[model samples]
Target: MFAGHDPYLVALSVIVAILGGYTGFGLAARIRGTPGLARRLLLAGAAGFLAVGIWTMHFVGMLAAPIPPAAAYLVLPTIISFLICALVVGISLFFVSIGDPSRQRVIASALLLGAGIVSMHYVGVHAVSGPFHIVHRPGMILLSSLIAVLSAYGGLRIYLARQGGLRLVLSAVAFGIAVSGMHYTAMHGMTFSTMPLDMVPMSDGLVASAQVLSLVVALLCFVIAAGFLLFLVPEPRPRPLAGFPGGFYPASEAPGPVSEGLQTASRSDRSVMTTAPLGGIGQPRQLPVQRIPVEAADGTRLVDVTEIRAIRADAHYTMVHDGQRERMCSWSISEAETKLDPAVFIRVHRSHIVSLPHVAFLRKEGDGAIVELDGPQPTIVPVSRAKIAEIRARLGLTKTVPPRH
Candidate 1:
């Protein structure tokens, strides 16, 4: 039944839907892990739920506005508008969902979705009917998107800090409540309406409260879903025969805890590079250590080893040098790695390992090519060659690619 709709009322409906959409996406992402049929089904369900929930919420909120006799004109456009809002919000949430199973991702996802919903609603409101008129200013849209992204990032950081303990759940609750409250508070601000609160028993508060509760409860369900999904979809198992170093034979007889620890430390570095000292002029440098074997995820074999003369840790990753050879790696040294095995590293590239001290020059050609050292001489690291840019970045090289023709 169509009824009277006010600008503020429309805004309220959109905000509620945004909250619902964010909650739904986060829940779906957490519950669905695999990338096949099951995940698709779960995602479809989430999208449907978001579409219906937002549409219904807004439809009800627009009760104050006069309805046109052209119901058909309204229905289709309304569905499309609500869907666009939900999809934008859901996509933001999707980005946040790919990170580690931390509370931060959930919160970030929620905030991003919320902000998307809000921005889209405001923009839509400006276009359709509201106290604010559409400006069609690209700057405003960019600014709004930027703000939303920042808020999402902040939410993610907060969530991450509060994950893994009873405090995590508490933080989630607090975050959800805070967001829901903020949504209502902002919605309430849309109008130049200085009108006093229209008291109709607890009905208004009840609806608002229910929506908030739903958002908070949905977040908790997402947490559970994420946990279970993580459990179900195990990490990628390293191939046993990918690369085995001479000493790294039997899984049991692999390096002891110390070596294991070192490998772990290397893996965690994430931006390590190994380079060999350049000859006379400013050239590549080698790492201090030499002959470190790259370990597979499975402790069974060693993918490869590099010779480095020096090591440099990048802002985000690690680098190691072995003579003229250079290798870039993501694995970094952490306290945990100090207690692991020596053969626990991964060979992301021919010239790179978990260690940053064994990388040579990373060269970009057609696909990608890395130049590393076998002994003291530079050996062409066999890689796809497409990964060269990635290698350079990992090595902290600042050279940019020439423009394509």
Candidate 2:
């Protein structure tokens, strides 16, 4: 016969699952902004959190079920199950984050993740050692597997979309449902049969008591709570005085004489400035930026202004497309515009800027226009209604019309 589950414990398990999902997904979202070792570490941490969440939820659900009094958990199998979850989760994340994740890659990753969840669930279930045998209905196992796959795909899509606020919360909730639903559904189809009195349980293998398991679960819960809190802490904004015209400098290294001009320059003029020695007396001259700072896997590198085809805004930072591939830039869109020569580069849209010299094609699209920049991998930048006329004039496309007939 099926075992009854504690409703309160079930609810608690769901909560733990949701919290873990939220924290793990939040960490993964930051992987895009980070580079190299930092990105790998973050990915690992995210996987660990997610694995812990799934493992914890499964055990909590198991605790809720009324198993035979003689049943105990095998330490080795329980530990192996958790390791399996972590390994698969890490592999899945790595697959998606490595390069441009295609549709096939995403699907493959999702399949792997879903299979990992199912494997962890069953492995954990089989860890129970006692004078009883467990059997699961084939149909229910298939249904649970389907739910796992679908839920995993949905979660990955949401993460890729990168929408924050309400969407992230909803995704976490859905993930919680997916994990808990699969566990309970499988449990529903499970039947336990008592073993014969002569049957002997293994005595050599180490086992964990319910009390010890409770302590472990409590410790994991605390770790998840701590991670959740740390994730909520907002990143400190860089101080205004910590930047220079051509690049960023420490506040302590900032020149004193130019500080006034730096503070007084308008957004557009901030990047166009000249400075003299600390005590020298001379009129300031123009010193436009020649190179743009961008981040790469190896390290921070500078891209020549002439090499930039387009710059797209990414929150507080910008993405620099250097005719080949896009690289993350530490500068804001406003900063990029101010620093680059206005004669060649133009801010065509709120979030986009294009190099006029690289303009290969321009076409009117509805109320605005689109300009294709010539490069190995051509980029299309949108032209806002306000900037359409200016973009046309800069590209020598503006034409005079004859008098009306």
- Per residue, candidate 1 scores C-alpha lDDT tens digits across 73-171 of 222344455667567545754554333334554555656565655554454343232222223345544454454455445444443332122433443
**How many pairs of residues collide in each model?**
90, 0
Candidate 2, residues 1-405: lDDT per residue as tens digits?
A: 334798888998998899898888878766656667988898999899989998999898888888887888899999999999999888888887655556798899999999999999999999988888898999999999988888888888777654344667877889888889988988988988998967856655889977788889889888888998898898664454323434543211234554333433343452333232223335463456899987754567888999999998755677788887666787877667666777888777767889989999999899988889898878777776666766777678889889998
For TM-score, the strongest prediction is 2
TM-score of predicted structure 2: 0.69
Worst 10 residues of 1 by lDDT: 200-209
Model 2 collision count: 0
Error of 2 at 2 (Å): 7.4
Candidate 2 displacement at residue 340 in angstroms? 6.4
